[model samples]
Target: MKPLLSIWIMLLCGIAGRSFAQTKTSTDTVVKPPVQLKTVHIVQYNFFKDSLAFREEYAKSLTFRRLKWYEVYGGLSVNINNLYRVTQFKKNKKKITFKHMLLNKEQEMFVSRVYTPSLVNKVTHLDGDSLQLFMQHYQPDYAFIKNASDYDLYLAIKKEYEAFMKTRDSIPVQP
Candidate 1:
């Protein structure tokens, strides 16, 4: 019985040693390359042209996007400032400026579309410096253009052209 017990203990020790040796040899034989980390580039939305929906989406992504220390500081400062009335006024001013810029651009586009050089030329039969002079002098305001129909605009241009022709010689031609 003592011999049998000794044999069982030796067998268990041998099995454990073999398993440990096998694991060690397996780990030693396998070669792993050093991990190479790739640089990640994050792109933020354009502030000028971004729509409200896009702004909302971008704000939602703030949690995942990694920002620099200064960027984080600046953002927090701006957000905190937004809670106060004085800082809010500054934001409102910026918005007003942006709105005015957009309105001005729209007005310019409307003027270009309705009071085109071609339309003026066709109406006046004038060319070169005189045509340019007439258009500049009689350039309709945004409000007038907005309120006037196509026919009204055409008649107005024709009438203005006639008036311009009468005083054509009187107006000084810029060199």
Candidate 2:
């Protein structure tokens, strides 16, 4: 009986020691995702609402598709400003910055409520004909071509258009 008891204790100690030794070393390595894997492109709508509304409401109001979510809810914006070093959309954690998103009249009005009156005047006054004329005649300067805001681009084209009109008016009429 004593011999049997000693054999059982030795067997139990051997099994415990083996289990402890196996756990001391880990072979697994930590893997990290690539930078590109985190970013996703989405065709966000050009919608802005001051109050909290359903996402369905935003979807309904969508006039055009853009590559980003615009500032709509002030609380969300404030929370973003407080929590994140960079303001990102609630849905995705991508960096938020201005992109050259075209705005229809309604969208323009929504944005212009926060923007300057001069910008509203400049943007609202330019019709399709003016846009076509500007595009046809205006060659923006190299400096103006790069990293220009929509407002800056419009102002540059409008200035060029006005210059072209002045030149055209000065040309003498052939009898």
- Candidate number of the best lDDT: 1
* lDDT tens readout by residue for model 1, 45-96: 4334444444455443322322333442454365443235343556556656
Candidate 1: worst 10 consecutive residues by lDDT? Answer: 60-69
What would the TM-score be for candidate 2 when compared with the true structure? 0.22
The weakest ten consecutive residues by lDDT in model 2 span: 94-103
- For 10-76, candidate 2 gives per-residue lDDT tens digits of 9999999999888876565457686665667896443344323433444434432223234333554
lDDT per model vs. reference: 0.71, 0.49
Query: In model 2, where do residues sit more than 4 Å from their true spots?
Result: 1-121, 141-143, 147-155, 167-175
TM-score of each: 0.47, 0.22
Query: Model 1: which residue pairs collide?
Result: none
